[model samples]
Target: MVRKEKLDSMFNAFSIVSGGNYVYVCDMKQDLSRWSKSAVDYFGLPSEYMENAQSIWNEHLHPTDREYFNESINAIFAGSDNNHTLEYRARRLDGEYVVCVCQGVVIHDDDGKPEYFCGSIKNHDSVNYIDDVTNLRSLYGFLDDLKSAFWKKQELDILMIGVEEFSRTNDIFGYTFGNRALRKLGSLLLSEFRCEGQVYRMDGTKFAVIAQKSSIQRLSEIYADLQETCAKEFYVGSDRLTLSLCAGALHLERFSVSPDTVYSCLRFALHESKGNHHGELFEFQEVVIDESRNSLTRLNEIRNSIVDECVGFELYYQPVVDAKTEEMCGAEALIRWRNNDYGLVPPFLFVPILEQDSLFPELGKWILREAMICGNRIRAKYPNFVMNVNLSYAQLERTDFVDVVLDLLKATHFPAKNLCLELTERCRLLDVKLLQNIFVRLREEGVRIALDDFGTGFSSLGVLRKLPIDCVKIDRDYVLNIQSNKEDRNTVKFISQLAEAFNAELCVEGVETAEMRDMLRKFNVTSFQGFYYSRPVPIEEFCVKYSC
Candidate 1:
């Protein structure tokens, strides 16, 4: 009798604290002790209904939750552990089920056997388990949950964006500046998107926004505005910097049939944004989805190649001949892959894929090693011959790249002067100081540095003043129609004059026609390369033609 009195007091205290119902079930017997007035009101049970609480309560439980609720209660009563927590649906008098969370503790008898279970039940309608700001979930977790919730209600549109060469900016300006820039971008996005959606910082250099269900046209308009906003120059500590943003957007209703499928679709859109420049926005289209699927399939095959160390990759050498003497000066090493089943895949198709993965470093090392061996083989015949190898942004930024090159030269017993490292202008813009250091060290050892595709990127006159370079290869676009297009001719002439001012040899690429060649010659261009001389060919073929 005393125990029952104490239990009733405990129930009353709980009811007062929670402002809700409380129940104490003793050993699964049909009778329950101490029901609260709030419980009666919440369950919509009359005063008379309390006499037979078990039957009344059983009828109020949602059909879907009835079995689980009963099972959990039984388990709590049978176990020695005093705690039980569960979420289930409870039907109201109107036959509507409301979600509820129940927490309870089991009371033990003198012998340590379960005697009764006491618990409090609360309505969970106001609780948002997925999006409580104080919970401090990770960025990825937040994005996943946000995507799922919006997709579930069919109320989401997503945009993914990345700042181009984000790594380079971080390297040159330090992460402090990079982070501040990103934060400023985040603030801008929040101000612009908060009224219509939620913005999430997806990763170090990527961001995503979720908009309520909207038309494709509306999304496109917003995306264009966002592109414009992102393209504007930012001033980081008076260092005026212009960074490009590439964006991809998708409507939740397009490919996502369920909330869980939204993330995958968003990822597909994000991947499509790679290699795009500022103001470039790619919308989610059926073709993109198909291509993404195909690319993923190919990615698996590429992964296997890395594991086996048997990348069926081949090297093709494009001769860079002296324009005046018509003598082959050096060859640019090009890579091509031919799978047994897929046949030949172009470098443009697979190189980007490799760049996106960890395999790029290994593949770059292989290319360097193979090119050195082949170049040395030819050098054996012509001691003064040189070879140029293209390096990607990833390979060049590696701290050990200089060491790798020096080691390769020593191993091959080839003169460092016989190898030229060709980098695009964009690569130079990455970290002018670091690249200068690398180039300076290489130049000190007699290795030449050539700026490849000079006019295509952020052409900083400051770069020429800072770095020591031996040659500047004008991009093929400027040379393509120079003979016919006066603008192209003038651009080439202007670049040629600048090269002369810098005391750098100017090599014009893609000189296919005699007229283009003559134009380059007239502009005082010294070196040239294109199909007119020879397309990239096998080492054996190149050696047979160029060997002295």
Candidate 2:
């Protein structure tokens, strides 16, 4: 049995962590009650309610829940149960319904009659289950609801929605205003799905909806509504923002799957929908399982190879040239994997998988060491030549990242001024202050920083204004059509102007055709890199051709 002192302490601790949770201590003989401050404020109960707490509970509980609530209490009083736990929807002072979980233990007097009940009531509206920013159910709450649905064998249509370019939004407007946009999105979802489903914040800029058993046509209609709604402009702090979102759906009745499997399938479908349907919804297919299984096996094999360093992993250098002179100015290091089973693995197939692994740090360091050593040799012939190496977000987050780079430069006898680190748009989750400090220290050491995949990501005018970068590598998407597509040409022209304003050099990558290179030069872009010059080749070949 829990003593009164222990119950008091538990109640005190519970009130602090559970948001609007309230503890009630009832004296049956005295017919009196006391409530935690949070509970009184949340429910807006008058002082008179303390005198008749039992009546107030019945009055506030929904009519459908009152019978169950009374039965549970009666069962405990009658000695059929030691305690009672109730989960039901109750009416709040605002005439809104709130799901609540309440558990109570009855204490008996010496005569065996119930003397008091100790209970804690948690309103689901509290932040314990809802996201503070979105006001939707959080991941924890989503899991709980999913479990309950599984137990009840209820059919649910699940959708996973992801905000495209959300990271760019945060980078440009700052996270404070980013949260406001998320809140607005949450409000929009709640209003639309109030009678259809429950919206949950699955992760940063990702949301999930669990809808009641509905027809496939209805689901499609809902998806279309969401897509159209999100396409409109968002008003945030004097700035109007346009956003895009993609969604993936899983029909629960079609298969028997665990909660984890549901999450995986939805995520995979979501990824496939990207650039496939232009933010439209994609349904999970049977092939997803086979693909996921094969992918995991391949990922495991590659992870082991990276860790053991037994697989043939090598770096190839592609030359970056001056547009006007057609002279090589620098080289970007690219990785290749020669596996006995897979033969040759292209980066598009393996790099994304590896970068998601924690062990990528080891691979990244290996690349850095090997690239710098090779670059040092190349520099012997051309002292002004620079080598650019891509840095993953994982590598940059390491506390020892800056130190490792500095040490590599010292060990390779490579000039820091000639070794550039390229950060890509794939780095979405970043600590801005931490990255800025790291960049500041690196710049002090004479190391150059470059932003790769420039026009493709959320690289806004604001991010360029704040980030301490030395170069911008325009993504191939923009450069490929710069000569033929007027929009592409205009985007490149604007980016070139921004680079000039920042005093940063612009290197237009994927410059395959003479027309593309010539068009970029018109915008005053001098540095170019792509197949037009040479595909990535072995160090020996690079040394023989460029004599470096």
Candidate 3:
């Protein structure tokens, strides 16, 4: 009795000295009796709570945390552990909730039997690491903990989880419901992967986990588990939401990986996974990363070359021949790159990358101006010469696209009728109606529109039906095998018929053989272009050969 009173007095003095923070002493072996003046007031507990503090604490804890609280407390009392430090949400007096960190030390009697556990309570509402919405650590907190482990030279695997097509979810159901889905997913991940690692809520629809010292095989298993979990549908309000997850992982070994580099590499891998490896985990490879970095550096050089009007940027023209006469009736303008160090960089390698960037429109403008100027210079000698320039989605979607073409024609005194803009299938159009309107205006201005790579995309028929296109350029795949493959010949015949029905010309690309040309002739292909007649050549060489 005397010993108990002395401990109580010490706790009371300590609580007062600690600026009224909640402090408690519990006789774990004896009915779990406890005392704390601050906790009594903060939790709205009566004096009776002291008789059974374990029960009272358990009652106020968040339901999800109840088992953990019991396990940790029981472990200490059973002498399996000497101390316990845990954070959990606890309900307060006015029905509000706050996260509290409780740390306790187990005291032993003369015979080393467990006697009591004493602890202080710290309210962590202001500086809590836990995200309020997801109940996971915030990105900042996760990075901090990750850096700590990284500095200690521990082998680690970091996985970034992204909710696929998440933007469509927000667009369809509104952000409020989107947030609910995220919260549910966060809870699901936390509950499922607690043993494997700590999960963190990354910015918008991206979550991450730091699996400490996990092997590649274990990470692969975890990734498979996550895929299965996300495959199940979740209910939000009355709507059922289904999500597909893409994960990217980077293995970090001690001195080899820096925090910044790890994040950069992991994010890059995640983007690749989302775009190309759907439902799979992409592990970072040094060679792939090095290639990407080198490509980016080379692209930067290309961008600088374009901006500075460097000689590295030039257009090469490939002859488009009349299939029967083999006459060079027109040509398609193709962009090429040449650097002092890399010599002539392959257009197949760089053009597609540039076409997807913002600078593509600017590059398109340059191509249009140069091609028009060259076409005007040659029109007197060859009145039937046509200038075909390719257009990317970035260029065609710009509001000033038609105006830019018109301005270039006026500046170069080039006939709009001779200028053809080829729209490639790779372009993604958001506003088909807007494009149709632009096409109508351009057609009125005497500019022809050709649908390039016609048979490749899902929207090819839709484009023909809706847009004012003048020509259909059948993709090369059908033409390459038309001589041997009956299906290829039938497809070409069908496309030729379809084009004629629309009052459009059908030009077959990739006619590399005399047999291919003869085969296309049967389908009434209006024009043929490929290595058979000529490959893309410099503007100077093209003028010297085909000017007259």
Assess every candidate by TM-score: 0.58, 0.52, 0.58
Which residue pairs of candidate 1 clash?
none
Task: Write the number of the candidate with greater TM-score, choosing between 1 and 2.
Answer: 1
Runs of candidate 2 exceeding 4 Å displacement? 1-293
Q: How many pairs of residues collide in model 2?
A: 0
Candidate 3 local lDDT, residue 207: 89
Q: TM-score order of candidates, best first?
A: 3, 1, 2
lDDT value, candidate 2, whole model: 0.77
Q: Can you write out model 3's per-residue Cα lDDT over 1-548, one digit (the tens) per residue?
A: 87667567656665665554577877665654555655777778876237667777899988867877898888886789999877677898988777777888877888988777777878765665667778789866665566556435567778888898898888998888788889988987887667778899977788888888566567778778867856765666667777888888877663433354455556666766876677688886543224234444455567667667645888889988887788888889998888876678767665655554556688888889989887876687878888999887778779898899899989989999999999886564346888788889999999999989988853377779888888889888878888789999899988989999899998889989888888789886889999888889987898888754
**Largest TM-score belongs to which candidate?**
3
Residue-wise lDDT of candidate 2 within 269-303, one digit each (tens)?
67657746778788864433242344434444566
lDDT for residue 206 in candidate 2, whole number 0-100: 87
Candidate 1 segments exceeding 4 Å error: 1-159, 163-202, 208-246, 249-280, 283-296, 303-307
Error of 3 at 89 (Å): 34
Candidate 1, residues 286-325, lDDT tens digits: the string is: 3232523444344445546655674777899998888898
